[model samples]
Target: MRRVQVRKTHKLFIGGAFPRSESGRTLVVEGANVARASRKDLRDAVRIARQAGAGWSGATAYNRGQVLYRLAEMMEARRGALAAACRGKDEVDRAIDRVVWYAGWADKLAQVIGSANAVAGPYFNFTVPEPTGVVGIVAPAEPALLGLVSRLAPPLVGGNTVVVIASDAHPIAAVELAECVATADVPPGVVNILTGLRGELAPWLAGHMDVAGLDLAGADGDAAELERLGAENVKRIVRGKADEQSPYEIAAFLELKTVWHPVGF
Candidate 1:
């Protein structure tokens, strides 16, 4: 009798195809080979994100919150898989914690990040944070899970759709998180994730005309090229600060809009 061997599955998740990158590229990861997404695939993700974003952004804040919390719940349920994908206890734990933390923020962000403002010039004013539409994030390479979770949370919590490029070296955990997003009830385009080499893909997304804002937190070395690319479209660039644990990240992904009204006579 002859022994049978099973082949491993390596494909891109796009429009439900799960096909290899259109460019037919592959890269090595953890002694295993994985598909390397092409520029065309990245553009496909952007198109998906754009088509789905308006409806997602228009969805009620409560609906968005429900979806985000659901993703966190899903993440919690899949901790074991995520742990395995990330390949470490600390990585998995931090990722899980990030989901839980951001889960709470979904409903509370309006209160925590918004406030009433007193206008010295006789008008009544209040300010609140609003979603800036489709956000493109370059997921960080180090501390993969936590960085990925941190990058995704704040923007989605604020009702924005996201297109994230997962870490190149450690891509599994990021893809696993996409499962959480899909099951969490998030609209398809609301959290489109692309698994590829960030160095290759980030520039294109940063410069994409349709992207409303950019989060380069996952990028390295001042992200000078990303910044320049984003400038072409006037996309808001969220700067990476020195403090990794700062709540400022929550606000960086948001836009402050002030509404003013006359104090009636």
Candidate 2:
């Protein structure tokens, strides 16, 4: 008997579950129906990220590191699927490597970027890094999987939950990476991935009051406008380049908090 091929449906990854866009729109890409998220979906994603942010950010840095390492493991297990989606194994390899690289920084971030104060007071003061809550990302179009992973990993490392708008032209890889994210045991709403036109999704995410940071490496046209929107909320904005696997990149998604304790207790 001749076998019939079943078409796969790609939907939005929100709150740790796959759901179709609230707008009921779809874009035909790579011979599949990829959900085209609307501003409503973006809002929903941000809400989920905000709810999940507290738990994820409050988790011990070591635990966050281990969770990221497991995500890298899952990505490795799904290498074939990810490679197929992106049309290249090199991209998948680098993507996995990037996840692992950021994972290693998760626990060490405090020591690396945090500092002890040298104040001339009868008190001990210290500055530490804390997650900036929900982060928004505009992933690059080229290098599909690698680009998405590059921008996504740093925020995860910093314990900041994210809602990313995937590359419009090439979204299959982002969708496939969401699979790895789901199976990696990440908390619900910790990382949400939306597939849609950046033009449609980015502005809402940038302007969202709950979203603490915005990475616009892939927001092509009108990025300046998005930056303007972000400025309104005092959102930390990254508009120039791809994410490198450095603690500094993680720091960009974090806020430094300082506290003092009386020394003569």
- Using lDDT as the measure, the top candidate is 2
lDDT of each: 0.76, 0.89
Whole-model lDDT, model 1: 0.76
Summarize candidate 2's per-residue lDDT along 1-265 as a digit string, tens digits: 9899885689999999999999999998877889999999999999999999889998998899999999999999988889998858888888898898888898888898999999998989999999988999999887888888888998888999999999988999999989899999899999999998888888899899999999998976678899999998899998635645666778888899999998994
User: Model 1 segments beyond 4 Å from truth?
Assistant: 1-8, 15-19, 120-122, 239-247, 263-265
Residue-level lDDT tens digits of model 1 in 1-265:
9879774555666643456788888888755577788888888878887787678767777777677777768877888878877757777777666666665665666687889986688788998888787888888776667778888887777777788888887787777787777677777677777776787888888989888888887778748988998999788898553225434576776788999988877
The number of clashing residue pairs in model 2 is 0
Q: How close is every model to the real structure, measured as TM-score?
A: 0.86, 0.96
List the candidate 2 regions with Cα displacement exceeding 4 Å: none
Q: For model 2, what is the alpha-carbon lDDT of residue 25?
A: 96
Residue 5 lDDT, candidate 1, scale 0-100: 70
